[model samples]
Target: MGRSPCCCHDAGVKKGPWTEEEDKALVEHIQKRGGHVGSWRGLPKAAGLNRCGKSCRLRWTNYLRPDIKRGNFSDDEERLIIALHAGLGNKWATIATHLEGRTDNEIKNYWNTHIRKKLLRMGVDPVTHQQLPPDHHLDGASASLLPEALLWAAAAARLGGLDTGALRQAQLLQHLLHTIGSNNDATNLIANLAAANSVLNSSSRIVPSHLLQDQMNMLSGTNYLQPGYLCNTTSNFTEQDVVQQQLIKDMSPGTSTFEAAGPADQHCNTTAAFAARDVAPAVDMLPVQEFAGLMEPMELQLPNLCSLESDSFWKDLLEDGYRL
Candidate 1:
């Protein structure tokens, strides 16, 4: 006899965009329960909602949660998202952590609807987040480069849990990839980065923080390093250094691993290696002038929230996709 299906769903459970009442019920229940639900599958029954557990979880995580920040992409945020995506690809959940109050779904949507299109218009491949050399054509090897879904899975498994410092450096490395392709302005930046990377990788011995800082002093002027200061080194490796060292050790043979290049030519090697994989470092062809424009903080999009006098208006606006 044929085996029974491994899973089943109840036909009685309602499925649709959550109604305001349902949203209220779920939020109220969670709040009353001290914001902890032991089992999502059991929560709907407890809250008297006729929705599936997965649906409830998704609705709360993606929308109804009080802490989720909703809005259009800020210019700085847009740039940071690109930098993160350039190195990390489409790991939206992982990327979401870097942006406080933003949800993975929101980030994913903005990237698909806005950033990806911009990159494409600029001749950058959305999947690899790399700018194609002019008139360049993809060959068999480049054409078959891994998809973002697969890349995300591999990265998730490899990363286990992320180290923010490591992630930041990886993003910077990608920025370096594309920046190197631009005009002469990046020459000094490249030189400084090469020197800094060498100091970081030179040995297990304690690297004087000043040496790395002096090498990357030019980086201070760039958008990537502008708002943030590099962490002062204690007597040991930050998580970033450990990850970098391991990355250098385990990447495929002759794969342009960071360790393979000497400081004299590290910049060239770093860019060319990942470029071959179609995920060359850096944001999409974002040149110096464009960088200057993005540096100015642009106005953020806010919800058209109505007066609090009509409490129901808020729900109506949210349902209409205007008020949230």
Candidate 2:
């Protein structure tokens, strides 16, 4: 036996975009009924429109609603969309819930047209937000060595006596690059490095360690300080101070913390310069001479990257995609 269709496709019912007159009719009809249309299947007839009930409902919900916001999306909205998409996959209807004025259709279109392309260009899989496999011929061993590279960079920045702000930025770049891998293209690599370097130069002011620790504890419920950790009893030093001092001593001149010969040592400065260039619009990267004047001698501490990893959310998004 053949199943019946959900919506009737009568010859009299129109399809496609709605006209101004049809819009007015639907609006007037809803207004007369206190904005409640009892049955969408009966809406077209009651509103004096030649459209299918499904079409009419779509138009009303996506376009003619009084609170519908149109035009360009704000930065906050864009970020919300990305985060939602990351957590929800292509469940546009669910993603739309967090965006006040956006429709599911609109969000779906925007993601396909804008965000997806951007992620691809950045060598990240839009669905997983993970780095794509690199082209080994172009990137060589460096392509697969991102984690080690980042650790070395962070250690170097600390040994160089970089201020806390620069150290934090280095940590952020490390996390971002490791998560969102870059392609082998020279331009892409340069852009990534420039962005990282810019992050360091733009904010040279140090945030108090106690305040940072408090925020971290609130978010992750983990103590920054471990029990029996060596510290001066009278000194008011945070965990950051201890980490920085350790890094400096470990890397100072004759230490085995880092090898003198490696790809990391050879390319660290160039990578930083490139990252700074990529993020130049948001924050300018100061020259070495200017950086010295602006920076203050402060201890460095690595952020708890593990606490920030939303594995369950990404897993759910992947599962949702598979289900759909």
Q: TM-score of every model? A: 0.50, 0.45
> After TM-score superposition, what is the CA distance of residue 269 in candidate 1 from its true location, in Å?
26
Alpha carbon RMSD to native, model 2: 17.1
Per-residue lDDT over 1-324 for candidate 1, one digit per residue giving the tens place of the 0 to 100 score: 885422118877898889999999999999998999778888888999999888989999999888988777665466557656654567798678667678999999999998777766655666654344457453343332222222223223333334543333223333333333321233344443444344322452112344335434523433221101111101112222332233334346556533543442343332323222222224444334333232121101011111111323222212222111
What would the per-residue lDDT of candidate 2 be over residues 225-321, giving only the tens digit for each residue? 1111111111122223332343344333442323332343223322222223222222233433333322222212343332332434323332333
Cα error of candidate 1 at position 135, Å? 6.1
Worst 10 residues of 2 by lDDT: 225-234
After superposition, which runs of candidate 1 have C-alpha atoms over 4 Å from their true positions? 1-8, 133-137, 143-193, 198-324
Q: List the residue pairs that clash in candidate 1.
A: 174-281, 174-282
Supply the TM-score for candidate 2. Answer: 0.45
Error of 1 at 208 (Å): 17
Instruction: Point to the candidate with the largest TM-score.
Output: 1
What TM-score does structure 1 among the candidates reach?
A: 0.50
